[model samples]
Target: MTDATTTTAEAETAARPWLDASLPVAERVELLLAEMTVEEKAGLLFQTMITMGEDGELAEADPVFGLPSNREFVLEKGMTHFNLLGVAPTAGAIARWHNKLQELAASTRLGIPVTISTDPRHSFTENPGAAMLAGPFSQWPDALGLAATRDAALVERFGDIARQEYTAVGIRVALHPQVDLATEPRWSRVLQTFGEDAELSGELGAAYIRGFQNGDAFGAESVSTMVKHFPGGGPQKDGEDPHFAYGREQVYPGGQFELHLKPFAAAFDAGVRQVMPYYGMPVDTEYEEVGFGFNKSVLTGLLRERFEFDGIVCTDWGLVNDAAIFGQPFPARAWGVEHLTPLERVEKILDAGADQFGGEACPELVLELVAQGRVDEQRLDVSVRRLLREKFALGLFENPFVDAEAADAIVGSAEFRAAGDAAQRASIAVLSNRDAVLPFTPGVKLYVEGIAPEVAAAYGEVVDSPADADLAVLRLQAPFEQRATMFENFFHAGSLEFSGDVVAHVAEVAAAVPTVVDVFLDRPAILGPVVEAASAVAGNWGASAAALLDVLSGAAPAGGRLPFDIPSSMAAVEASRPDVPFDTADPLFRFGHGLTL
Candidate 1:
């Protein structure tokens, strides 16, 4: 190259250094950071949920959740990061919407592309605050089901498939791989976690990260994994979640706080790019009693200094501001720091070393803090640099738009659905198969509850009642005490014991004929009575009716082992330490317990 040509190229680079793909990411980050206004930098600190407009357009507003219009969020507030809420009819719809969102972002002063994140959506659960149901995406068993398979390779494959689907629709971040241990049986969020064993959770969590980030090298193809609930979110007092004010305490009766952190260590080792501290406040531990989001001793001292994690640390939602959920008002989950004002909350979160505020959009407070000298502009630059570097590394600056048409083919493809169905079948754990009655002869008269009669007709004769049938199959959800509030009901916390009515119904069906009962083990249940009544018992996590029948009818092999212990009684669960794994005495079925076909 001639000197004149080199000089021309250098001039072009200097004109738009941040957009030059040839430049190093670090150099590009610095260039972008230097150009960003204080308001734009403030916008980078907040990442909240965004809803799509009708027919894939930008949402005008969501009065239900009290969210501002997408235009106001971007053009007015200058926020760039969003955790996409809800699903569309087709993958093309999502992809088209993403392009539109990116276009809106492209119109910004610096043209910094929006980093779209999502909660786990490729599963059956549809908790608005936590996860979304697999609408257009291929549906897989929940995380616990993956743990039951005990195959790290399969978990990695699932991650890779999910990554492909995510990127096809322009989603750049996964706010998941919730590596918290399910040591507490009544914990509301256990289904999303790999079961009680730390080693297993660690191994699978690492594989999950590898799959999402495309084997540790993050680029355009990668969906950055935000390994979450740092220092662990399990061991909730009485197994209640911290999402509610009443459930704020996180206790460790067994002094096993270190055990709960094992999975996060594995996630960190696997090159996870972001972290989210849980809403729960530590109780009786060496750390401060505030929520992890505001606990500087935990976030800065343990996670940053001890673990040496320099990646983005984001708080779990609604830490600094009170918000309405499902049209019901709830206080901000400030925990021990509730006395602080919203501005003070923001100052504390920044001081605690978190880079971004999850589930909030309050850039004005940041600006105010800066003006008041409570927060320095340099501190904002630190987080802004980290955030910008990620965008550059992800190749978002080069091209934030995705091929919308390709999304229809990639997401929920026939091959992907087939894989998900196979996983669903593989995850059904046969807990008890009395008198070797499982591989039921085809065309046997069957009575069923929960299993759709139309779907069950393929395997056998669909009978009206257990008395008129040769075999009966019933599906049951693991028992949970219903809470008072509507939002609280979504989280199935409280007791793990089934009601008397449920037990009596199961007994009645079993008395008429040999019965097979399958329970959805979202939370481990005291299943001794159910096991005794039924001839065969199976446990599932998000398997469809067809998938369950495929395994029971000998069409596919039963491959799942129990991911956690099934307690013999409620007394056993209450006696066990909240932080200790497999602590329940005389569990009905032990961890890794499964009967083969």
Candidate 2:
């Protein structure tokens, strides 16, 4: 090494001290924080949804969510963080799009690289707000199915695999492993949770964090996890979601507030990097009645002081402002503080000690608060420090671009897909197998509903009708009453009991021939009538037709236990408290009930 080259490198390091990898993370964060202007600092406080453009180009606009162009979000808003909404047709396309975004950020004054995050993209659930279907990614079962397997090691392995896939496409953060206990069987988001048990959720949640964060440390290879809906988002009143206005109240009728905090405690133990509080306001609790995002008693007192957590706390989407989604306009989820204006809501959220606003792109509000002397610049720096430190710890400042050519080979590779397929098969819970009705003999005539003919033919002959077949196989989804709004309909929140029409149809098919029924148990369904009608009944979270057939044909073991109790009737569900687990009397299938067949 020549002295001239060494001197030039040293001078370059002095020009951008934050770029020097040898410095401590804290020192790097402070150095970057000092260099950022107020607009850039304000941008760090808002992380909203960003979409990919056509042909891996920069998106000019998004009419669906009314989001501005990527250029405006980066240049005008001075933003460097985003929650990637959708994926491209191919992994390489997504990687190219990510690189284009980084190139735009590089053109900025400070050149702070963008940090990309995403919701659970390896699942079948397509609730745009929650999870996306595994398009061009490895397909796996929902979180509830992972709980049914009761294998922390398997869960951890899934996380590690997911981390690798996410990083390949330039995603630095994972917005999931929703650890909320599914105490309320009727709740719409139950499928995303671990289960109704605190200890089990805590154990699995910690393992998930370990897998994503690369074994309890955040580094270049790690994908930072934002363990969320903190203080628990389950136990909604009447099993409705907090996403809509009618479902805003989160009741603790059983007075079990502390129990809901168990999984988050496990998350904290596993060294989670970020937290997102739910939109529901507490009812009859010691804390304020306002939403968790604006509740200082819970965010500051409980999380910060009592738990001594110093991670970045981000609010759930659309707390301070609301906009049109799916062509329908929605109001802000202010909950108990609905009377306050958007500006006032911002003030309360910042005062509550939240670091960022999820699903919001408004840094101008923070600028307004700063100019009016309502918010101290020093207060903003506290969160800016944490936010910048994460970008440094993630190694985003050094190399934000992914190798676009390598993404296609790495993501959804044959090995990774096989692991996901095995998980899908293992997660199928055989709730009932009367007289060894399963292990269906090969070449038996079979009538199928949801199973595609080509996939079913591998196990048995596929018949068009149940009457012409030797046996019948039906795939059904758990029942949920339809809501008025299009967005609300996605949330499957209503009666767990099967409707009269569905029960009669199942009985008709079973009466025609010996039947095997598989119900997609997003929520715990009342399966008593179906159990009586069918020769065999199974529960699956998310599995392909081939995976389900493999378990039924004795090729693979039915390796899942029930993640939550299935109520006997709607009356039992109505009688049980929302916050109490296993409170329903004489549940048809108790938690952990599954057959070995």
Candidate 3:
């Protein structure tokens, strides 16, 4: 007979079934779920961005979000998942901070290990509250550049490198491989996607998923990938981003809805662990006109039932909660159900079959729903079990902390950086060679734009203007219609045409000297004018100036293909329907348009 008077010390020392690695993961999940309180279960449903003090310690309060202390959020509120934002100065510093954070998690009553997640940090794109700058990580070209390369092997390699870096720093979840089709040329977020082709995007998305998750499961040394914006977020109306009120509705005039689902389907087949729906509302589709998070027809009918995807479904950031960014108030993106209270929004998300609400920290509302009998505790068990299963599958129960020194050594290693540099050079796509003007002589007089003086000096004598030079090399960005607010400017959306001044400047340079023009194609640009004006034209997806120079000088072959078609004009772009892939009529440069010198 067991004595009820046994010491609390003895009970604490006894091994739990959930802690036994020998048991099946499913059994471990059930055992843990049986022991959890409602508060702990509710905590599994919310994931919010967590802030840290500059010294790698828990901040008393976050300056931007005004969030509660890490101690209060984790121990008191029972949050075991967090999205880490901002850059840490060194890999060793971030690793040590992760160790301390894990130690805190281990000290909790149930000793549940925390699982840290991150947005894409391997690229140049920077959103203060979303992505981190590449401090100690290897910087690769943007996702679009990888698409331009058309090398699945290279994409897999990037994924593998990213996995190693993420695992070392205790970031076990990757919130990307975005997988959305870049069918809409003017969409700002296309830089993060794998260009416009369904087959290519799907192929690369699968490779990316395999690289991050490391095969079929979230084992040790793996970072689980969360494939996002399901059923395609690319077919946005008039190319405006859905972040603001004016861009909430996604209109699919082309009736090519099936094309966008291909990448997500491939992601699932590749064993992706999580999915995130976008914030846009589907207008006039078969599904209800609601945000994906609140649309049961979209989340449940399409993603869950039709696709049979059993992975965790999480909503995109801030759908239910109104947030302030840099003192500007942004309303909740609840789309169709704007009239609903925060409580109702939470309920709808759950009912729509999402397991988690992103960019939110309101588990208390979940608890209230259960207390009010609006949600079944048994129903809550489903999401909690799935969440706990992932923690187990990741082998977090066995070990969660990382070796700080190893992290420093492994991250941004010379070999990794070299591979990324090679990829950058490989992604540069030469679009035109008029009169064979490229492959410049080492001592020619050169006029350049968007290239550093020191960098341009290596190829030739860099002149101040076109008239003083024998050749002009200009690098320009794909143009976008500038939005009003500072927050909106960060996203390059709207028009695809270069303004009159930019067009005239390039033309004037070409008139004075034999010009080689290269534009960074983050999105497909209206390049008919630039192509006509320049003696030779080139395009790159996230390639550096050094890489571009290598291609132009014939030091390296331009090995990339145009991932999307270049629009002939702004009029052609507007006449095309948003939903259809490759629907633009008479494209100036067709898909797979690349020229070798």
Candidate 4:
């Protein structure tokens, strides 16, 4: 161990006496608050990931940066609150790293334990394309799948399981329970959100918060839930996402923006501690024409004033410049306010009443803003006070260390795995079964395509491909953002029309056998041809694929309604007003429209 680690361990051991709960909460908070410096308090607001190097050790950097490197600078300068990055190979290693970091924080006069936060990690597929992998955490289905099951109890159970896994690894804050309704199917981030229904989404979202925080009322292990995208993030223009430059506008023609806010209201009522504004700019609303990260009218006026929310507000990533990843320099999120410099953006973010700057690793800009007297020190003090109070409320000061031995025992345990499987089974939706084409009788040779071979074999003799199947099972995906020459940025500028060859292939398979089509409606695509050719059609948001299969096999019943209208064509999507989502002149499938046995 390094000198910093040794010193920190000694300090942690020594400071245990002062962490007693017998003291009043105010007294403890006051004592801890008095010990922190401006620099140290500022450090608490900045979170960065600590990555493991290629040689299997923590990478070193300049301590002046207060990141993972520059060990001496970190110890001397006193930075706390790290977003533990890159999963470790073993729980023991994670525990060790966390303990060492806490020890370092404790060595400082205030000894405020670093409160580590994490995005969702316990999902079945790690979603490397979107979120971090579940290498060390317990694996569960994605949020869309959780929403499909329509079971509030299951949602809570999943939260409870994730809380156990997170707490075991010393992650006190969960930066999730996205709560945003997936109204716009084409949004790349839809897989992470709950389905498009406002009421159902709100109830389930609240249950998620309650589960993570638990009813402990005053326990340290109770995870702090960060309900995100304050108002909502479901009304992207033309089914485009906010991540890209062109897709930054969120429209609201159907008056569905208010519907989207319902779930967030539910999250707030549940006592969630943090709120994250989306990167999308709302064009139709009275709020500023910029993304919610920079819009004070939305963040301060609407979320804080109207909703009466009093939680910490953090901006989405890429809001400020000065950090580079992969050799590419990212600009500050000056989405609507194009003229603001990086420093100006920081001032605006603070003035808009946001508490923390997310996706930003550099704190020098913040420090510079403070030093220049551009941002009031009292403003910083208010946010820091709330942050520290949350840490105490989470019991981080009392028990900063995690029980390493319990880590493996709880993560992916048989019980948790069983719950995940049950959730998966429940979430699948069976949309259509014309003429009772489903529940194939036993001994019938079944021909399947596009589904996993293992999954297909469960039904009957699985065929080699579409041509040889007794019943053609075609799996489909919603139209994705297309790239030019496989090198350009994926911009949403394409039609939902499938390639002629793809349509031809499906038609050919339909001609050869009785066909059943299943679409993973991550986005609502024009399915006129498939719906015309196939004997039956099924559609679902995220995890509905497996559920549809189960329903077809008579293992389960189909019971999901379309959360948003399936537009008849791309023309309808483009011609519709920019503000309202699912506001097409005419829809192929209306919202809440579904079929069953």
Candidate 5:
């Protein structure tokens, strides 16, 4: 036979023996492990987010696409796992595409199935911070809104819905339930978290995990939950995020670190199968300078040692290289011990004991490390073993295919959509309403902005703009820092400061009409202007525009209290110590402060 024919025959033979379900999970794992070489094992540990490129190749491969050329490289290097980026238009096409990829990976020795993961897809807004507008995915209300409903059953229901949607299109992992406490209002990533309270965040996060796992003790379609940013990500100094070089420290003064850990403990107790460390470092604290990805104290000492968590621990992305996205040069998360090469960073991360390198585009680097004796093959084996075991635990070997038709039915189902709407309604918190400038009686000429017309119609006549209405409703976002060209494109710096234009506009609207202003407080910003101008002002812990509207129209009561204190000004935030836990002596809105109707 020719070389091509011989290779094809070998591939076919290798796949034939594993179709039997009678084989034990351990036996299957060992068989697969034995078949994989060091190169293949290393590839399994490095997962990349896949999207289509301009040249009809994976976006991470095309030079023009600005992503690392890891797709072609993974195939060449014998990689086995990938996290599907964004959603496809049709569930059928996504399943077909995923099946084809699995076929290619199975063509090699072992026939190991490729496990695809995704961020939360069944929400109203696709988490813009994580993935860009690539294709269609089921959108749902932000987690904060979910928390507002205080319905654990609804949270579980949402999880089941997400699980069905994920399994239908071949995704087996859900990287979510970011159980981090929103203890710091200035933190930019708070919108993605459950909310500020420890007990609530933990309880809801656990319910979310149970919902996703769906009692399928071991199966492929049973979506595994990767509860993330362990030991919590909230409590950053001045509300700055750790994605950038400057804002990498995680401080704790209010003993909030322990509070943050509550949710994770709940998640672990609930049997969450996976964990992802935060990108921020515990600088000027008891822990070392590097991020949790490379912090043994946090990962090995706390999570593994104390909690006894046996789940897979994946790191946040881009920790091993200096790459630029959107015309900015961002360094790999070299937080504490500054002067290290990408290769050196990888070594430190391995030593710190992370199972996988997230957002990684290079398996070749892992191979090179193994070849140079910098990283041990046994260490690679350990992580690979855990990874493969999870695939087995997920029963991927038994059932790799999903019913695409069922997926379409599950996604955006009436039940799930209603849950989203309910969450949106529940999460809205009315912070101030001195004159009862709410529940605008019907037939009142209402001028509204920032709220959808359909949503505003429920209250009264919806106007085209703030100027035309009897009452103006303005939507606002908490201020975040702008990054320089030399920093990560999305990473924020400095304190939470609102735009002058936004403040001026709110004042303009409030002066003309009895206005109600809703601020999407992803990060807590100074609300002096908002509190002073608008007759009534509201804030949401998460992104729930619909929920804010519900509070305005008397459909839902504002029950959420501030998880973190809203700082008075950016200067006060900047002067605060990075090592201290949220001990801002004087804040605008103290923790546990909330107004009721």
Candidate 6:
């Protein structure tokens, strides 16, 4: 009888050495590989995204990001890996959902537990396509703000907190700690990076990797980190993001190609288990001017040979398939090889030394390619070995389930929230405290904008306008030029200057009272006009008004410095090249600029 038709008694006595955890992980992996069918081996190559319904069940709603229901993707498709999108309401809800998902995996013939990964979920960013909301997770500042504090210890501390929460909810892979340096300040995605300093980015990135991996290596307690945008993604042409066709080229006009490679080396040294290459094609480089996902020279030669990295390399999402997301059509980011067919794209990606494909659920194409005598099954095994090694390293063969009951108590505990709040306060940078107008006396009437009246009233009286208050407080987000698509708008990009109307409004507040200005510098905003208009100015990446008030009122001190230089004007930023760091002439605020009250 075939394996599928075997009885329970026959299956139990099958002599599966892979089921033995006491044996070496490599030997177990080898034994398991020998018994797998071609279809089973192909399942491990796909890592598509999955979403949950409001009731914490498998979502059967209309397609999101052009994806089908989880049942089809997980059970019928034989897929074992998923990047979790959207968050559950409670910690226990996520835990329960994860348990149910794992139950589905357990019923499969091989019983390979599904591995769930997620983008950064502990930050203030709520871009549905890019980052998940920090609901029930301790919300901290974005990566740039962490870099502003310039404390590797603090970054590690945040990572530790993130690890606790992730493990509680059964998240096993962190698809983040984006090590791409913010060399191009105008790039839309800079807000998520660690800033423009290569050395600082490298230092903090290694510390972050250590925290997720649960100290020097991957184990049952560890969450594997996928340090992303390999070879760096910060040098986009004219600061345009590579997710769109218009932003497809990554130019090196400043000729600093080696500078971008620094942080990846640091991540590799830190024993990062996975690497993700970006979508943009490198222009004027020695290698082929193809997208980094298809650049064999970059992946095989530079990463594998020169850097000596022996880890799983996955491509960024949707590089080999054309699909629609949120009703807008998106073409595959086959930048240099746009002329190739979908099958050819897959062939090229596999040949380029990548182990897995992101945002793709097609393995039949590969099965067909192998059947055609074009691609070898042994070549496919190379990636399967790396993938299986991670699963074994994570102890999925033993127990892949989490304590659904303990998830609530462990995730988003009161102590974790308090620490996250303190981090928000500490990341506030006092850029200018002219005449010590801050630290306003308690019980004074205050008029606030963009802050809750009750929150502001806790410190002082809340009034209607600047004319009726002791000091006018204003909170403003960094500015961005509008884009065509709704999804593009989520990524803040373009001009750093405030609009004429915004400048006039802040000036009116400054004229009426001693206005205290707080700018949320997701990316550095040109602050020349705002500084001249306000009596006092402070900068924060992302913080609640209470946290900012605690720092402004001297209950806590603002210790953060400029992680990156703030350009003096749009003219300066436009004049700078895309590949260079801190190249803006005469910055308004230089890197490492911060003051104390």
Residue 116's lDDT within candidate 6 is 89
> Highest TM-score: which candidate?
2
How accurate locally, in lDDT, is each candidate?
Answer: 0.91, 0.90, 0.86, 0.70, 0.72, 0.87
| Root-mean-square deviation (CA) per prediction | 2.3, 1.4, 3.3, 4.5, 4.6, 3.2
Mind giving the per-residue lDDT tens digits that candidate 6 earns over 1-597?
A: 765656653455366668677789898889888887788888888897888656556666345566777777777777888998887778888888888888888788887888989999988864556678898888898888888889999888888889989999899999988988787777888877889999999999999988888887579888999998988999988788889888889988999999999998899888899999999999988989999999999999999999988788889999888988778888999999999988889899999999988989998888887888878999889999899999999987677889989998988899999988988888889898777897777778899998999899889989997899998889998898898888888878887789999999999999999989999887789999999999888898778899999988888987988889999988998888888999999998998999977
Least well predicted 10-residue stretch by lDDT in candidate 6: 5-14
How would you order the candidates by lDDT, starting with the best? 1, 2, 6, 3, 5, 4
Clashes of each: 0, 0, 0, 15, 13, 0
Clashing pairs in 3: none
Question: How does each model score on TM-score?
Answer: 0.97, 0.98, 0.96, 0.87, 0.87, 0.97
Give, for candidate 1, the lowest lDDT window spanning 10 residues.
Answer: 124-133
Q: Write the per-residue lDDT of candidate 3 for residues 392-451, one digit (tens) a residue.
A: 989988889899889889999999888888888888888988889877777799898999
Ranking of all predicted structures according to TM-score, beginning with the best and ending with the worst = 2, 1, 6, 3, 5, 4
- Candidate 2 has which clashing residue pairs, if any? none
In candidate 2, what residue range of length 10 has the lowest lDDT sum? 124-133
The superposed Cα distance between candidate 5 and the true structure at residue 431, in angstroms, equals 2.0
**Error of model 1, residue 327, in angstroms:** 2.2
* Model 2, span 401-471: residue lDDT tens: 99999999999999999999999999998888887778888899999999889999988888888889988
Task: List candidate 6 stretches off by more than 4 Å.
Answer: 1-15
Q: List model 5 lDDT by residue over 1-597, tens digit each.
A: 899997876675466544445677677777778777887888788876776433223345544335444346446756666776655666666776666666666566666777888876655443355533324344455676676556778788778777876777788888888988766655667667776677878888988998889854536557888898876887787667778766788887554466678889999888899999988887556777778898988888888899998779999887887766655566777688568878888888888888998887677788889899888899888888889888887777666666655665665567666665666666566778868877656556777776677876777788766667788878876666665553333443345776788888888888778898887765667887788888988776444455666667766766666555677776776666433335555877776566776
Q: Write the per-residue lDDT of candidate 1 for residues 104-201, one digit (tens) a residue.
A: 99888777899999999898763555789788999999999999999999999999999999999999899999999999999989999999999999
